[model samples]
Target chain A: MLLALATASFRIESSFRAQFWFKLLSGVLNVIARVSIWQSVFLHGAGSTDISLPQMITYAILGATTFSTWDATQILREIGADIRSGNVVSHLMRPYSYPVSLYARQLGARAHEMLMIGLPVLVVMGSVYGFQLPASPGHAALFILSLLLSIFLLFTVSIAASMIGFWVMDMLALEWSLRGTLALFSGGLVPLWFYPDAVANTVLYLPFAWISFYPLAIYLGELDLLSSLLHLLYGLSWAVVSAVLVALMWRAACRRMIVQGG
Target chain B: MRQSLSLYLYLIRLQLRTRLQYRASLIIGWVAQAFGYASVYGAIWIVASRFEKLGGWVWPEIALMLGFHVLGYALGALFTLVQLRRMEELVRLGTYDTLLVRPVSPWAYLVFSGFNIEYGGHIALGIGMMVWALPQLGMDWSLLTVLQLVASLISAALLTGSILTMIAAMALVLTRSRYLFGIYFDFWELSRYPITIFAMPLQFVLLSVVPLGYMAYVPIAALLGKPVPVIGEAAPFTAILAGPFMVGVAILVWQSCQRRYQGAGG
Candidate 1:
């Protein structure tokens, strides 16, 4: 049933051919902007001697592609709308879990986007800026594991954020705050390596690190094999913790809905 | 023109009154917008502080550029946000016909009906940056310079409004063209930084093709005694013309597209 929902989502997304082109164009343009900013940074010889231009370029490419899979803002907005219109109540009537089914549908759309938009962006920008390969095959395999964990981690966090809509009427404000936090803390734009030691040390331990920092760090060979494995374990723990939190929040939200007769 | 101006103000007043009903959300949205923009620019600032400069732009100078970009965009968004964002909806619902049949000029009517007072946060942030950054730059604040700065800001607003209006015009011909705004925003992201950071070809595209440089970089550069791309010393003067030129172009495109807009069959 979930598979059917996902497939339907993929088909619905594919039908919007014109939107696909625009999305692809924007994705590609975004990578270009990122690359230009980094190029100028390195060209001017700013920052420390540790990180190189190639690594920053690769970070920007991956930041725009593989790691950019989900959009927390748009998803939260949808959830908020459902709550506002009392559409969420109907979901509870179904046998399947609402969050899981929503995830499945989003997964289908994201899969389509990654293939259709993400790959093109990666190839085009990667070729233009010379995208860096993984540190080694061992690291490459580890990066994939971390990437999967990050996806789950991000989804749980988003779900937890969405649960706020159960109480707050102002979802738009909530959405922006979530987006701001994600963009800054996720290391999706500037790598934590270049961050001040004080910030880098603190952010390295945060759950947001797994979203883009740790996976990209692992790929770039910033973390050795022993540390990569350790980081992946840490990321998994964060994801599990977030999942539990999301479940608790979901339960509370459902209770609130019933109490209010939504 | 005076009549249209008054009509626009009256319509905007109505929108403001309606919007005032949601006082709590309005304040919350404002705070969120301020925080959102702060983080977005904060990321760039982090990178800049680490590197000390970007394309020869120090953090202070970049702040000024950001000021212009945000202020101009906020001003433009006041008139064009509705058209740019909801054009597809209007086209989809066949509301274009309703707009056309109204006694007032549809252009003014459409522009003001969607008046976005939500950009108050952006305007405040923009002015704050400009005010904060100006003293740090040590640039002369002559009367002429001040006038030029004000004119340049107006030009930026016009250019931004025109660009969004042009994109919204596409909805008239192709109702599902909202995604083109994505392309515009992609460029907008690039504009937040120094254009000199981009390759020459991209810089050219930003200048002549899209004229985004006029939106912030060129005018700011000229004001700071930095060499303006291509035009050099005459950059600020040329920047003044950008608003009128783009407005003319946007009007032409909008008119032509509306003429071709057959109603979405009910």
Candidate 2:
């Protein structure tokens, strides 16, 4: 699933004009980071006394990626819109699985974003801030693996949210509210570590932390392999539970479709 | 001017009527916006609680600044929602030509044509915050202070509206630009806090290039009896200047865009 998503994301960068703006924004971010005090403050606080280029790049990637997950629900809404418009029937008739197809498209979109927007921004920000690279190859590998897992967990959460549209008409408000909550709580706008300890402790139990904080923590060296593995275990558990709920919802939704001829 | 006032009232009434049709949705949107903004402010408050002051400004002063900023943003967004959202559509479809044909000034029509009455809720929220924060900040009430606050708000509205108009003008040139407006909005979002939080160069950029500093900073500074840093140094004079500058810039941009417009469905 992760491989498919990564492939799709890459495909988008190759095909779309979105790369121009992505590059422009990334360049602007790089310039801003180089000149802006906010960048210095963030770097000073996040890294050890001395920040390196790689560490800064890693932080930039982690920040952008974490924030990007907020868009997952929007992808779900697009899927729901397809279903409402009878487009889903065509996909259902195809040999390929419906969920997998949607997932592929989403993965493509994210891959495109990661390459065009995320990578350049990270590189620029890293160079400007002089961020340190990971101390060892093993840590880098661990970070990459945890990041992949985080993407999967985020995808699952989005699927779950999108499934709610099948039961409710006009999921716009609900989707927005959910996205806003996720952005606020999932360490997107502000890192979870910055929150009061009591709040952070409570949020750790929620699924949102797995979507952003855990993966970011792994990259920041805040979490070692053992701890990352434990976090992944929690994420996989949530994914299974969410997948089951989605299956149940899909079955019920199918029944509704037949009865209502929708 | 009398005709413009009447037209503004008529447009506002029409918007109010349209918004009343979706009472629930309007209320929900308002609540959601208030909650979202409040959460960010809450975060700021939490951070400030750890420190006695930020950039030489204490909590109440910060609250006042936020109050003005929120009020200005809400007013700008509500009044200019259609222009902000549809600048690209107008440019692409050449619908802006219709405004040119109307007897009213194209700039006036463009800025005031589409209103979101729902944003009235935001104004209420801003006022509530200002009132709430006033006592917390240990402010003494006076007639002059009240007048200054009202004047500052009016100036803020003008400054914000004009800046949006300037961005919209860019749309006329960059038709089909996906995130032109989004970029503008992101800039606006960046302005929510005091410009002091940013470094000196950024502070200059915000003041001169974007003029966001003129929005709430100037007015709030004057109201708080602080030395005005930029245009706010003139206080009421600069406050009055905002509207004319907006009208002038809007007219200039519209005139230039008119030459580029080729007409719709050609």
Candidate 3:
């Protein structure tokens, strides 16, 4: 099953408006952090940090862009609200699959947002800090593949989390808990490598790692080519399992909703 | 004054009863919030493990900052944001009209009716974190120090409430152009870290532009008996005056905004 445990991780959160604010403000903080980091470098004037000042700025900027995931739970919340408001009937009447339609719409919005907002932020950052391209053709291709899987994985997680709303009638708590868990595991703010080994191991292997860490790791050439390929395969299996689970969940949810007329 | 206090308590009681009706769901929300907060708390642990210290503040010290930050925000969020969440819409939806006709203050009516228990959990969490961190600092107990911390914590809450009040008032005036104003809230995330780590000019901005430095950093420094760079030793004592001044400003802004408001489409 694609959705397992009704507790998948790595789906995206936050709104485009929120990101617009977050990234734009981060641009201001990015410069300040750069100065302090460089001062630290000059202070000892030796013993290099794993990530440099320029690279850290890139990470900070990219961190904002990447943190906005394929937010399936948001769509699930939308559908759940429809059910509550007695508007879900229209969606049920439509010829196409409601869940698929939700995914497609989000895909389009994410693409549009990435291009219109995310890319321009990167371009501005690039002008100042000097952007680095992904390591090689093979690695870049694998990174793209991993990114797509991560989005799918996240979407499934959101689906699982939102399905609880069918029973609870309020998805806020579930969503909050899911978001917290995802943020801790996803390494959206910091690289997993920075974490202690015991904590890092458990966090790294989790599905949330694919969300922000893995794809970005490949872009930075932090992962080796072979390991990248291996991770891509592993992530694909997780996505496949989650999808199967989600299909079963959708069936059960619809059956219950159909009975309840909600 | 007693009449108003009774009104406020009665309203809060009504909300609490309504929430308690959904007993299972309400408790679950607190659990969820705890986990959500726990995740951010975990990040601090990870960062501390990797680095010896941040801005000369250890994890215990940082916890004091973070704890007070949560305390201030929890208190402020308890009252103001319920309206600000839909301030522009409240006017458009004519919800404001209902409140305007009320004998009690519109601000009180707006927030009290939408009172949330989500903040109660945050207060507990904030205080729990502070208590947890305090013993680790190994400081001698002093009646004056205890008083200063309590005063600073309350001041921080007032500062937060004032900021949100200003935003709520602004939301009423600038509906279509409210996007930029809403974004200001996001900047408060920066204050979660050690403000001392930030450079001089940015530090100034945090204090003036956001006033978050007062929320955690300034008060926190006072408790630690550490003087803020350049601002000197007097900053801690100044926090007491700043809190009331900020709240007064919030009331003044909220009042002016209410006066300028001529109802929806008027």
Candidate 1 achieves a global lDDT of 0.85
Candidate 3 lDDT over A13-39, as tens digits, reads: 233455566555554454345334333
- After superposition, the stretches of candidate 2 with alpha carbons farther than 4 Å from their true spots are A1-19, A26-61, A69-73, A76-98, A166-172, A257-262, B1-11, B50-60, B94-113, B225-240
| Superposed model 3: Cα runs more than 4 Å off | A1-23, A26-54, A69-77, A259-262, B176-182
By descending TM-score, how would the candidates be arranged? 1, 3, 2
Over A1-262, each residue of candidate 2 has an lDDT whose tens digit, in order, gives 5566558666755764654574457445333432332343343323223434444345545566334554567776687687777776776677766666666777777766666676676676556545556545666787677677667767767776777677655455556666666766676544566567888789887878777777666767767777766877887787778767767777776677642353
Error of 1 at B175 (Å): 1.7
lDDT of 1 by residue, A1-262 (tens): 9999989988998998888888888888888888888888898846675888898899899998878732646778888999998889999989998888877887787788788889988998899889899999999999989988887877777778888889986788888888888778888888888778888899889999899889999999999999999989988989888888888888888878862452
The backbone clash count of each candidate, in order, is 0, 12, 11
Q: How far off is residue B173 in model 3, in Å?
A: 1.0
Instruction: Assess every candidate by TM-score.
Output: 0.96, 0.82, 0.89
In model 2, the fraction of reference contacts reproduced equals 0.05
Candidate 3 falls in which docking quality class?
Answer: acceptable
| Best candidate (score: TM-score) | 1
Which prediction has the highest DockQ against the true structure? 1
Tell me candidate 3's fraction of native contacts, as a decimal between 0 and 1.
0.48
Using lDDT as the measure, which candidate wins?
A: 1
Q: In model 1, which runs have C-alpha deviations exceeding 4 angstroms?
A: A258-262, B1-5
lDDT of 1 by residue, B1-266 (tens): 78877888898899999999998889888888878888778888888888899999999999999988999989988888765688888888877778888888777788887788888788889999999999998887889999989998999999999999989888888877778887888888888888989888888888889788898998899899898776777898977888878999999999999889887766
